[model samples]
Target chain A: MDAVRPVFYVSDGTGITAETIGHSLLTQFSGSRFQTDRLPFVDTPDRARDAANRIRAAGEAARTRPIVVTSCVDGSLTALVAESGALMLDVFAPFIEPLERELGEARQQRVGQAHGIVDFDTYHRRINAMNYALTHDDGISMNYDEADLILVGVSRAGKTPTCVYLALHHGIRAANYPLTPDDLEEERLPAKLRQHRNKLFGLTIDPIRLHQIRQERRANSRYAQLDTCKREVAQAEAMLRREGIEMLSTTHASIEEISSRVLEHLGINREMY
Target chain B: MDAVRPVFYVSDGTGITAETIGHSLLTQFSGSRFQTDRLPFVDTPDRARDAANRIRAAGEAARTRPIVVTSCVDGSLTALVAESGALMLDVFAPFIEPLERELGEARQQRVGQAHGIVDFDTYHRRINAMNYALTHDDGISMNYDEADLILVGVSRAGKTPTCVYLALHHGIRAANYPLTPDDLEEERLPAKLRQHRNKLFGLTIDPIRLHQIRQERRANSRYAQLDTCKREVAQAEAMLRREGIEMLSTTHASIEEISSRVLEHLGINREMY
Candidate 1:
């Protein structure tokens, strides 16, 4: 932990895939500290050599072998990066061999398409969904006809971030309807949302977490009080239970977790673009 | 090509890591088509068996061996999935041994952290950046002191979506300034943006694509006219060039590609949260 190891993600494209895989792998070694770098778009041999040189320089500076994760489809690029005397891990290579054996066809020497614009329709849909998420956020729009999912929760209960995540990541038209004080008092599904009940997903947080989150927005106010939080959470849970809406707590969960569960429950298995 | 192969992404956590790797691999085999499914949170042995059953059922339905990509760190869960007579690809297992060798310590058998809220600060930063992006989008706020990056472009030239992507994906406080006709004619960045010149990045789009995008918003108006698009884009490009601001064309690039390039240009080495 004292000597931070240098890590590099080298790729022919954006290197995002390489970085994501590297980050996930690093998490398992919690005791180790790593200083990471990204050398993206190393398509040409010159760029690949430069990436290798950078890795070697980092190695000389750190006085240890750098760990390199390469997601390059072209084998030559990965080989060049590995020639820098680093512990190179080809994230896609191990899978490619097995995939070839299964399919009985060789994988093509193509660049990774993790972040490219291969599908214009998908691109537009993401942008459109983002626009939809913005306009329909926080009960601003009662029109839930086009929303793929409608997130219902109390104020400061972590609805907006999840909505944004759903739209931006999954291309889902996610509108959030905050269960206002009046709605909670009614103890019934909002009339407009009742029709779109199939699209409704409820989110709740622990009262303490909710209070803390709200306190950040409005300090020392009734809205941020623990009592108010507990009451609203209890009411929201009761209302959701009565309405037969499946829900999850976002207190310990990430936005990705909440959105993934929502998609799973709804049986939306669309590929993330 | 005639038959759509069935593919499954099984993981102890959200299965996002497995799915992401699978998706990128699938892109390499353009000649093959696939029907993909995600089985997230298969932590328990029972859940793992259920996931395996699902994979086997899909194989039976397709009359072809299914491809299973597993990101489970625990050996037991992955073993259960592999027993279903599918070609199982353990995404994490192959890397663990190498990472262990490099660190001179064993990797933990914990779940992947690709989608979990392991870092509270990082999670909150993402949510806060999202809020900031929303509040500061489309010239909504002139404040730039706090912005990590400011995106300026003509209307519908893909600023808002890019900003949202930056916020939601990279936890970047990205604000967009739509270069209006007035600003284009003046041949200078808006006065408010001059102070934050180093933070400024420009986005441009092909005039025809811009025309098409605008037509969807307000059909048959001057705003959607090809001439208007051409003039605005040309002027915006020239002005950005004259102001010594780096720019990229979003016409053919995905939002992820554009955002990655911007972060690279700005030298922001933030790990995507």
Candidate 2:
């Protein structure tokens, strides 16, 4: 029986979490003596069939008993379990029964929607807006045209982490463009953003704080100087007023509040905790 | 105002999240600038008082508008807000009212109980069991006396992970001892564990899978050979019976299941999830 082996099944979409958890679990049984294999993302029937065949073949070759553990959030989980022909220990199975009982006929359509409630149209729209924000570092033409809301700030004002956090956690499509020296020099909105002036929102902070953050990366560089930070912030704020950009001082707010305030200003739903 | 600075407050515990949120909010201003300072881990009354004094001193020295964004999870959060004497944004403040309304006193107490509960008697018993298991590696006098429960198996039987996981996550002390050729030669419990045998638990697996896991760590070593694994497993089980030790095959079990079964054997509280 020592010649027998074991096989593992991983069928979740984005198999990363499943693989990590499975590895952690298996590492605990060093003395148990088992072999493991992973079959991930079997979303289609043919893929499920292939996985089943592989598991069966591995079992047939085993000299002792066989065990298969599987994880998937989709209905394909049920399909993979049926095909594996080994004892299955399903982690997310308990939630399925309660969901069916609660949703009734709508449960068929609600399969993956337990984790996400927003429609796909809204999801894609937000993703596109965020994509725009990531690419356009300075507020320009697309800032007024596509962004549901625009984030304006001096350099290193934390626009990226906030934008990414909103996108990942709350499905908010947030774009941020920095207010730079040239923009402040002109003291006017960029030509592309002139039409949608009302959609622009600006963030300002204590220059000293901005200086400290800059110093961490550049260490005594011109950009990290306290006097330079003070001057640039003053210029950016004056230019925002001259260009008719509405703004807020980030000196006293939280990310949740800031993101929600932007959403509130734009009349969009705020979904963060 | 240009010469005036801003202050930033950063927390030690949940400050990372607070700073991200605070920065997002600050980016919205089109005009004006300030300074920032970080205040971490002011959860206690004394720390809050110290933070208040520091903020007061910084504000007195600054010429610009002073803003403070804070995040803390204790009653001292409110105390700090009252004492800061600046334009304050308390990030975690919003959570308290909502959680209080949802959980009420009973549920809050229960949550506290879960975190604070430590059965000292059980803890000592488990630690002794682990120490004994480390030395005996088989059912015997010391093993039985020390262990509230004993795990036995061939090499790589996963005793360490299971035992450690129990201790770390659930505060359930566990000790696992391996069965080796020396134990089987005697056809009895190891000399140290000969007295307290009832607490013994044994684990086995499909010998082939055991060989595969062993081969990864020690390729071509006799210990990784299928025949050797099978022989050791058989001998271990035979010795368990000869010495009246109990055993389980871990070839197809998940950690959750293994943990649950162990709890069942020990009459301990099982994890509901």
Candidate 3:
């Protein structure tokens, strides 16, 4: 096994943007193993010193210069991290100058502004979307009129998480309904779902994968059997085809991917950050 | 305002990974305006042609070449997007060959692998964490034993969304409690919260900011009054200090920032992808 190298994602705010980009970069180096740590809210000189010390200690322990990916808006703090005897990758520094030149204005060097709660309207929209997803999950509420999208799938076909992700990340109101055996038996969409046909998107999965997922939750049950999963997926897919609704398979997709595809398919432009 | 550039996030599967990285890159260019579109699930040659046509149309309409950021693992689809007369930024293509060389294995050219539901364990963990956050929110449940972190703050200090973000993004089981006026009057930590002191993290905000946030939710109410907000914030900060709990201000922080800071302060390592 390759020795794990210490990797730090440092930011003056939440460090999520740094981590997201850093993780993408790290994923490309398949031979390297990384022990990642996030250091967020390092807004002060004192905190910067502490982060530098931590980075130094990590490098010493690993016997190699640690990789520090940072997105600090504060120039002094960015300089401090760069001088910490580590391989520092400043995510923001390289682009800020070019952006300033392009836009003909000075960049805001304020900490946390990039991901801050400065826009309460956007924040409330996200929260309201999340609440909507939670309330309308699993057909618990028949409030399709309020939903920007409605996902239909068999059990464990990745409906709930996708809805949650859509709601939380993009402020899109998503509701999900599980297509149960009862709904599949009739060879037709549920009455409630039929009324919101325009809002409905279907998700189908490979039976083998669906069975494996179901077995984890309910081992040895009839519902977890391969035949049951096969039948359910087939019926659900047929129903979607019959209704002329676009569908996607969740077999090899992440919640992020599923939500994005749904949005694209629905021709809904994502709300800006 | 600057003329808006057409920006396309294109992918063979879900365009989320491309969009995420592209969005981070664009954030640095604060002066430029971008009209963004997501084209997902371009797995087939026909769909790729459609995407290329769309990009061409967008560029022609804007009278400037569109910027295309893509994560299409399929070579043909990627090539098609590149030939679309746009400034192409292939996120996955630049690193795949180097990774294959380093790992001594041929890369899996599977679309959607980057954000697939291959790890059922991680999926379940995230779902479980989300359920935990929902059940334990607002001190509605005293199940702190299962909570990895409990956030305490005055009402509308941005607790619920932070908890939801932590759970959904990082699979962190977070609960939140609102520090009410009743708790502040006693000048002591709530008995239920004191028992779980080790898990507690405080969230504070500028009184004016808190008042503004509260006014949106409960307009013309005592809870939204500036004086009330000032008193509650003062009491909450003092109580957190007295209890020796680590606290962060959400006045200028994003939910991502707040969650990441909370995780960092708690010294909890996030589960890796």
Candidate 4:
């Protein structure tokens, strides 16, 4: 068994930024197994000490120094955390001075949360996009006219998760319409979907993969049968190709990859939250 | 007028990690306005040059030096991107040496993607949690028995977004049920919820905020009226208190903050992806 190492993300805020960057770094070092935890809202010196103690205890228990990645802006809090028996990676340490020089101003004081809700408009855009996704999910509402991108494919082609990711992460209004057998039987796109041809992005998966996914949902059903899966996927691909919709095979792709391709194909440039 | 500064998160991979940490750092520079864009998948020399030109062009167009935060692993790619007229913040540059010394090994080769799909198990948890969130959204299904957390709250008090965030980020199966007028007036936890009180979390919002949200859905209706909002919020809070359920005010809280509180309260120590 690989050695188990303890890692902590200590942040004065949600610690999400620390964890995200730390995870990326950890991916680079793949030899040892890591058990990770986060000490969030560690703004005050008291909380910082508490976090340090936890890190120290984790190191002691594991018999290896814990690695703590922090995003705290306060120097004193960071200093306190540095005392822990750990390799501390400060997310903001290198960028601060250069940024201060570039902007010609000292960093502003914050109430200690990382996500900057610069305006209610920015916040509302995320929530509104989420609402649109949920309301138009599974073709419950065919408001394709308002959708920024429409995902079209057979059932379980990884549409809903991609829609949710796009909405929550990029503030993009994404709606998904599943292609049933009835729709797949015909060559042309659904009238509503044809209207939004520019917005359509199709997702296809390996029939074997789709079969495995469906098998878990319903055992031995026609939907889970390999023959039915192959037929539906073939028809779906043909229809998508005939209609000139951009298609991607989601068999081995993560939602991040699929969502990225959808946005790139649609020319939708949005910041990922 | 506030001058617009161009910001780029250029990466050999998704650039999501760069963008997230960069946003936190940007929060400190509150005086300047920033327009951010991401150039992902710059793994090759030609792609790196293209990204560099885009960064240089954005700076020229905006009449300001662009600020670039890159999470590139390839030294050559990083060097190419650095030649752009921008303040380059290399995300991994600060910690690489220290990490190498501590880990006693060089970083592994990656396929230019930040997300480390170490195992399909991690991937499945995220998708499974997402399906649970959708199936159980807005009291659509009463599978509280399988839920890791169940959010009980008034509609528009920010339950759905929190559930989605928890599932997507932490792989926690969170389901939400909206407390309607009838449910709030009963003064006891619903029979279904009572059985799983440990998993129940209540969300309440200010009536003014609730009224504003509801008004957008149905203008000038009884549900959107301020009086109805006040009464419903009051009754919901009272019922939560009577049932000994923990409640939170979602009026000013972001989904990140609320999700953190819920996990902390519930002692769910899952890593954030």
Q: Say which candidate scores most in DockQ.
A: 1
The segments of candidate 1 whose C-alpha lies over 4 angstroms from its true place after superposition are: none
Residue A247, model 1: Cα distance from true site in angstroms: 1.4
Task: State interface RMSD in Å for all models.
Answer: 1.3, 18.7, 3.7, 2.0
Task: Identify the superior model by lDDT, candidate 1 or candidate 4.
Answer: 1
Q: Encode model 2's per-residue lDDT on B1-273: one tens digit a residue.
A: 354445555342324344434443443232435454545444566767777777777777774435666645444454665475766655444433432342231112111111122343433333333334334443333324535566777777756545533543344545676777787677777765555466567777778878976886699999999999988888888888776665666665433345445665555642210
Model 4 vs truth, CA RMSD: 1.8
List, residue by residue over A72-148, the lDDT tens digit for candidate 1.
Answer: 88888788888899998998988888888788778888775777765668878888888888889869676788888
What range of 10 consecutive residues in model 3 chain A has the weakest lDDT sum? A94-103
TM-score order of candidates, best first?
A: 1, 4, 3, 2
Each candidate's number of clashing pairs is 0, 58, 1, 0
Please state the CAPRI-style docking class of candidate 1: medium
Model 2: interface root-mean-square deviation in Å: 18.7
* Two-chain DockQ for each candidate model: 0.72, 0.01, 0.37, 0.61
Error of 4 at A262 (Å): 1.3
Give per-residue CA lDDT, model 2, range A1-273, as digits (tens).
245356464553323233333333333333355576655545567767776777777777874444554445555555655676665544334333432332231223222222222333443443344445445544554545655666777886756545644554345556777777776677776665666566677778779877876786599999899998998899888878777666766554444345545554565643321
Off by over 4 Å in 3: A44-46, A73-76, A92-111, A206-234, A271-273, B42-49, B71-82, B89-113, B180-186, B205-235, B271-273
How do the residues B1-273 of candidate 1 rate in per-residue lDDT, one tens digit apiece? Answer: 367799998888888788878888988887778999989989899998898888899989988999998889889888888888999888887888888988988888777477876556776788888888888986857778999999999999888888877887778899889999999999988899999999999999999989988998899999999999999999999999999999999988888788888988999887766
lDDT of 4 by residue, B103-174 (tens): 887887574546623345766788899889988987868878889999998888889999999998889999
DockQ of 3: 0.37
Candidate achieving the largest TM-score? 1
